[model samples]
Target: MQEQKRPQFKVFNTPELLETILLHLDNRTLLVSAQRVCQTWTVLVQTSPAIQEALFFQSQEHKWHAESISSPIYNPLLVQAFRPFFPSVHEYPPIHNNTNENATEFQAEAEHHGRDEDSHFSFKALDMLSSPQKKTAYMRKEASWRKMLLRQPPVYGGVTIFKMHHNMGGDSCRSYEVQEETPQANQENKESDDDHKMLKMGHFFTAFIHNEDLYFGRFGHTRIYWSTYVPPYESDLDGRAGGSYPPQGGSYSRKVIENFAREIVRSEVVAFSREVTQCCVGGKTNLTQEESLRKEILEAESDDRV
Candidate 1:
């Protein structure tokens, strides 16, 4: 007998009930793509801020957690890595993704730890992002990333690609590209006639958020050049940026990635909130602090407590 067909979930269930179901379902790719097929779904999804955040904010509640600093962007960055095995980009569309809610222990580990980018990594990181148009790009442990990165759409126009680029224009917002120095490069810098920069590469990117254009490849971890946001983030405090990142540890690569990832995500969210404001030519953005001129509003909570 033909399986009894049922009404679409949206048609049968109320919005709140539907959202509760969406919250439990681990099928993000299918759900996200489905939102595009109908006005009802599109509105239901876009209006639900919780669902929007859930896409990027992997959580234990959803049975997903940060097993590695690289987990967040691993999907997109590893697309090139999985290309050779899959062979065709068209094969990895959003619809046919097999998302088992009951993922195996090792499978979850791979997803959290970046779908094996570390295993097949040729150098310290993975290889370059061979353009999708080019045939036979190097993929990490063929078919490994496919589990996590269900869909590999083109860079610019694909709806599934992480938001193409943030466009909050002004002098305050600044994009950064920080390359980690190898041991040889570190020694070379020390021997140079100029001052020595440590295992710690000198911080280059800084801004008061509202001041300029922003384009640090948040997810571009193509082993060729991994971009990083060097920190103690610049805040209202002078010279010192706001949040202090953990010190560079040759052994603790995971720690370094995790700290920077949090800071990067937080900074991106702030810029989107319109919190970044203007300043004069020689002035700084003072971004982390909100705009508050009133004395009571500006003072510390400890002042009231005391």
Candidate 2:
């Protein structure tokens, strides 16, 4: 009886065996586990293009689980160490070398804008705009939004609205048009384009001082006619107010535009995930493991087709 202990049989080996083991596992958990197993497993999981594709496919099938996963463990200290040499977001424009008089004036302006007042802008209006049911509910609650122009005193300045033309470059320009909508027009347009067209909403109006006076307009609306004067800035198109604008001529850099685009993409992804979770979970039977597995397989096959 004392000599009855036998050797433990090892089972995992070969690509086929590994793939089989991975098939039943949740994608994100598998990825995390693979990453922690050993240097060999990490290299296999990370470097193998096939495995990477499979992981994404599996993850997409069970995306609701993403909410439960831990935040990505990135090395912040390492990131900081290299940040100066490899800046993630572009650097802010250099401060102008100025006399004390100008510096004081700049500081005052910065303090006024730097306060968290910008955070009040809400994207709820845009969300309502996107959903027919919500739009109806919103209209029932607030029948009409009054439009008013608040006049600055004569000593401060006045405001003006102008129609700006967009240059679409080449023959494609003919397809682009700007149509201002009244409430009735907006409803009509929504109904007409319900099946075909996608609406592009501009970020909320933001006021910027240009030539020692304040000017405000929706960010994307400002782009209806491109101007050398209006510098680019990151903005949430759905928000009630436009985001902060960089210094004059500061936004001409490609990096600035790319960062803005990335923010938009991130927002889009969040919106998409929320939509999926709401529709999938609320409308029918909860997604089953078998169905999720089938979806992962189909997605993986689709990747091969691509």
Candidate 3:
């Protein structure tokens, strides 16, 4: 006896099918394959905000994005650049008299946070910068001086009055005073006052805020300078200008920075392709080997940490 033919399953609607495919496409290859299936699939993959956001978040979570990695890790740089400013508590003796009172106050303020003696005075600086309501009582005690210094520029005339002061424990801090320049004295005079004035105009502060800690630094010289890395502008691409490259014109603009980053990414992609080709030529046949190579490529493309 002839058995009844099994009923054929109906194909899902296009959107439903696309969604199902997307759900299963955790791997980049499979995702690309789904995109190539049809015009509808391609458009859905390309234009869906939810899908893009999810992909981006997942890639970042997996450390797959290059720009994310290349962003300069600022903490080390901050420590290096500012550490020399503070006096070391171990090598030198503490100041005496009324000045000793200020030192004690500074020490107490620093210790109240429970930070180790060797920690940079950045915490103190940050404390000073903090809001009135948030500042510790000790910080509030010295609020007037902090506020005055914060309001004033560190450098004036032909000298930088803010000399680096090291505490007894080797922590660094800045102390402000007039530094008179004597023409006859032995000092490094790399640039004239006129040159410095020109450079000041080119200088900008780049501030980076990470995990509630704020780092600000001056970059550039007479030809060009960058302001501290502030929070990304509304128009900023990839945010923080971390992946951005200096433009040819020696100026920082959104378009130029974006283009610079794109070019770097493009170059990285080209290099990655060459490496893959070389690996294949070397007779590497394992899929895992290939995947490892690809992962390395993606990492190399990620942000350049200074």
Candidate 4:
């Protein structure tokens, strides 16, 4: 009798079928796990246009496409992956009034969600290069997130990172704000369009590491006062230049939603820093003694707290 033959799973070998299936995955899974499945999967994820757009590697053009996405989709691989380092505005009670009645409410909500208010929320300026996550998966050359975009479809404005310091009776109240770039009518917009352009994960990390003092500050401590505004949509615009526009919580058009997101992200792009890019990507060996020591301390604190 002839030996029986077993069937081969040929579906996995088909690039078209594989691409379709892979596109269904969330950005994190696609970057962290799915691409590691096989050489074929790796190639498909790296090369497929649809997959690239979904990963935020390339810009999405359609207004309908942006509108269809209901929830606020942050950079899954960049921001979400290292979420602890980037706290949203909602994370804290108004920085000025930590002792306000709402502080209890915010703490209750944070606790109810299994989040630690102290660890997740920090008023101190933190060097992201010192974040524990950087020493692990993010530092690897094979990390797909390094190539990912900071935001999907690429917002028209840049990102804003401000550190605010308020001194009340010698007690300094400090906090950092990270929001999308606000479009000022000032001459600052005179810079090239690239100045307002979004950055890839690698480029963003490079800028953050190099512009450490500029962003977080080095002078024994002072507040970085910054304000953001909402641009009135054409329909919502009144005769008055700064008159009341529609409430933010109210329904918004695709244009309004996109514009809001655009202002938050595209206000002022950081100039790329080639020097620190090598330090982060290659290894910490090139980092100064102070930076290396700081990184170790932060990583240790994280381990101990856990």
Candidate 5:
């Protein structure tokens, strides 16, 4: 036991090795908790460009990096930013836009190989979007939500909950509830703490390819007035020099792929959309109420048919 004391471990001496380790660290730990560990670590993490890039690339904006790290995730803006680090494809995959009839054709091929080739081909939007943000988790969350929504389809009340993005990189995406015109009777009696707690953070976008499905973003959000190209002299002109790009409550697609996704998700997005205001994503009461109401209504309607 005394002789074992002679075997002292060599201390990690280089900042580069530390940088790589820090880069690999969980984002929250690195930002909120890790830096506070020690002065040397704080300086190293704060000053390291690689760490900064890693953090930036992990933002909800880079839904692809989180959701689809294996195959090429198709966001031009993010691709440009990360082009230097990207593996150069010896030959660019042929543009499948329009030339292919099925927008989801790539999915069939992915499915054949199954998880053997790609674990994330199924594209778990919410799984990739968890608070701590893990890079490679398979997600059926969206599919499960779809089943829940479609099982008892809601009346076309319009988008109750909308998650919309800041164009390019304007601001974080946000959700707005339709704010129910019918106020609850016990509104005043309800404790303030009982009110739905709004989680302020989420991912929203016009279009992204996840598994076989075309998702607007990893999360849901509605359209905003942000657009670079404002089509003027159109019949439905937004009544300004630069009108709302998708038009308010209009088509959310901007790019070719977005247009395709609009077609795919339109019915699904619309059926679930309602007109409730200030509703928060995953708000306890709000979420429970919506799910319960939809479940009841759908079941009742099915009974009526029976």
Candidate 6:
């Protein structure tokens, strides 16, 4: 009986079996914990195409046919990490966070949502935006986000940027939406005779990482203000505020910057900003003529802030 002892079979030691097991894990766990288990697990996580797509490092090409209203999931890590920059109505209530006008309403709504200010997700978002000290670390060349997609389905339409301007009279928004023209259109204009092209998500990432100042717009009760500058954007159709964003004179020209900004404000306007901009002034969805003008200005301004 003493000589009858048998060797133990280790299931995880098998790479094929282990990869199958790991494929079941959520993205956060794979990145945070499983990858650290051992070198084998790490390699599997990094090399597995399915796992890579799950982490949003690679596009889910097969899922393209299945794309529905919510078929493709938003990159959860990006949603959490860049939460402030990508505001949401369900997550961040449309409230004047920096003001006290709707204190009671905002408090009640926040409580209803069970908003946990101390949560790690909230902390990360706040820390990224408010803490300049950590920017250097995040800006590293090897940062995980450098290769990550902004959206899991991958934004093939390209990225749009908006800049919002703040002022006493009223806020205004401008975008380089006009810059994303087709080759035929570009040929027709001929004004933009260079190799200037539309900015993509990768371009946004490059610009964001290199930039020192973080420019975001606040959708207040009645207005959208790009907190970068205290002045209004240039009124000219192609004019841009010096040192505003999308950075002028390089791959992203003034025209490209303008068009991108416009696209973000209209199509991808922050949910929190949109709701607050609509309801904050009077808590009314119906806008008066004056309020309507303010909303219009705010929408335009929202793009600049992007």
Q: Which scores better on lDDT, 1 or 6?
A: 6
What does the lDDT read for residue 213 in candidate 2?
19
Using lDDT as the measure, the top candidate is 6
Q: Model 6, residue 211: displacement in angstroms?
A: 6.9
Model 4 ranges off by over 4 Å: 1-8, 63-72, 89-137, 140-143, 157-196, 212-306
- Quantify all predictions' global Cα lDDT against the true fold: 0.28, 0.29, 0.29, 0.43, 0.31, 0.44
Q: Residue by residue across 165-239, what tens digits does model 6's lDDT show? A: 344433445443223335665776654433223223334444432322223223322111222111112333223
- On the 0 to 100 scale, the lDDT of residue 88 in model 5 is 21
lDDT string, candidate 1, 1-306, tens digits: 223344564443477776666666454443556576678666766567565434422212223333432222323333343332221121211112222322233233434555334321121121322342221222222322222322211111101101112123421212243332345555656443121221110111011111223212222111111112122222222112112121111112234334344444433211111122223335443432112211212232224335
List TM-scores for all candidates, in order. Answer: 0.25, 0.21, 0.20, 0.46, 0.27, 0.47
Residue lDDT tens for model 5, 3-25: 54542311233687777777777
Candidate 2 shows a clash count of 1
Off by over 4 Å in 5: 1-13, 26-29, 57-288, 291-306
lDDT tens string, model 4, 40-93?
788888888888888887766464375785333447555545453334422433
Q: Which sections of candidate 6 miss by over 4 Å?
A: 1-10, 64-71, 89-124, 129-136, 164-173, 177-306
TM-score leaderboard ranking: 6, 4, 5, 1, 2, 3
Better of 4 and 5 by lDDT: 4
Better of 5 and 6 by TM-score: 6
